[model samples]
Target: MRCVVMFSIRMDMRVILFLTLFTGLCIADSKGNLALNGMAVQSSLGHPQGDAQHAVDGNRDSDYKKESCTITKTEFNPWWRVDLGNVYSVSNVTITNRGDCCKDRLRGAQIRIGNKLDNNGNNNELAATILTAPNGTQTFSFESVNGRYVNIFLPGNDEILTLCEVEVFAVIDTPSYICGPRNLALGATAVQSSILSGAGAQRAVDGNRNSLFSLGSCSHTNADRDPWWRVDLGEKYKVTRVSITNIGDGSAARINGAQIRIGNSLENNGNNNELAVTVVSIPLGETKTFQFQPIKGRYVNIVIPGRNEYLHMCEVEVFSD
Candidate 1:
């Protein structure tokens, strides 16, 4: 009788252990970071000083998507580039429109960043226009706070995105995000290559130089008012960085907001819905780049909640810690 009792007690312990492990895996697969500690995250709209300098890009990768490099659709026309330097701070940025011949000069333009993006709401968070140059290359920086991701939109008058060179500088001692909500301790940032759509959408690049990013959508011309998209990283992963490029559909297209979330999906109205998660949005597209304070999980959901038309989503990327 005593021997039987001992055997039964051991079996009970093993069952408990198995159950705990199984539960942990389920949470990791489902709620992701929320399955752990994702209950205390807020939006960072009015974050302090988040504007930085315009930088230049060097051809680092054979694929041109490796390290900070220039990407020009045409040759020497408007050769555009970006520099991924450690986060410092800045105020304004100046760009040199190195037009080839015929004063292929630049005209009006706008800057983009993480904050200016909609935080899943109609919150108008905009970085100030420090300076504009229709004449020549100039410098710009904003000191309202600290920001790293930067982009200068030189709306082509005719058909000229002729970017010659892009130069960037820094200010703050620490990387931005100190005031922003994404208090991420990042490793390296990479752009998810072709996998930007379909399944494996949320999958990020390996710590290696893997060019693959699948988040949010580029620009949807179909104009599905309630248009939406999602990402699945195969297995759960630790997300700690982001970089986005978006050119809102039109001037009146107010729905260029990004509703970002983390969690597992359960069935939705007709499809699956991201359940038990933490979500936030940034209206303006990622000016240059955006990093979050390391959140452990796998799935990330980007919802638009059906707003404006022509509200295209450009390159949506995520990074592992």
Candidate 2:
């Protein structure tokens, strides 16, 4: 009886060891990532003229100015990611870095996978890090994870994220739109350095397009150097674009050199804020839109530098995502 019991115990130990080795082998064999082309890719911010879907369009071009991929300004915890649409067992994530410039921008990037929306899906389980050479295409394989969202985030100050393409090998599912938050400027307050009587600052954002604030309905500033008009978007947003409709009848030229600025500060009349673009020309009575590499700000200012011209805007529109 004792000999039979010893033989059974040895057999059980051998089985356990074999199972452990077999599981390891299975994971190793699954290291080849599943291609995730055509997935919905998004970023914390997007340039106004470019869409976020470029990261998953299967294009490997990395030129920042090409508008084919996503790029974010230097900020705290910049992130970009993809949504698999439905939960799937993700095997690995492969990232294609910008081969043209700023290759070092991808180092220390953390690839996270989970379903949570907290912190824009960044507060998830970390899968891997781009610790090796930060250029070209690199693959990071890991244990299979069940998730609908796969995010790549750079944590810390002044982290700028740029992605040419991201491929996820996973059990397949169709993706949904993953754009960032929408326009948050509808009911915010407005202020100007000076306002002409009868044309309050509120006219610019009253959702009225044809109504001219300078034609007795729009806000107007005195003939002071650096005449400025501003709108408070109520809260900070990842500003994607700003649109302004110029009043016709030869009044549009007054806004020709105006600078569109955005930021959290009101210093230097908000001139210290980051400059998005300068208006070269806007056709008479036409609405012109200016886009930036999505910037975060609560205030949007349309100011003519170097005083003596009235800052007239018929309508101002802001959009995110």
Which candidate comes out best when scored by lDDT? 2
- The CA lDDT at 185 in model 2 is 47
Residue 138 error for model 2, in Å? 62
Clashing pairs in 2: 34-169, 213-217, 213-218, 224-308, 225-307, 226-307
Each model's TM-score? 0.33, 0.43
The sequence of per-residue lDDT tens digits that candidate 2 reaches over residues 137-236 is: 7778887777667888887898778887777764322232121222344436888878767566777765444434434435666776888888898778
Tell me the spans in candidate 2 whose CA falls farther than 4 Å from its real position: 1-182, 211-216
**Per-model RMSD to reference:** 18.2, 20.8
lDDT of each: 0.33, 0.67
* Candidate 2 structure lDDT: 0.67
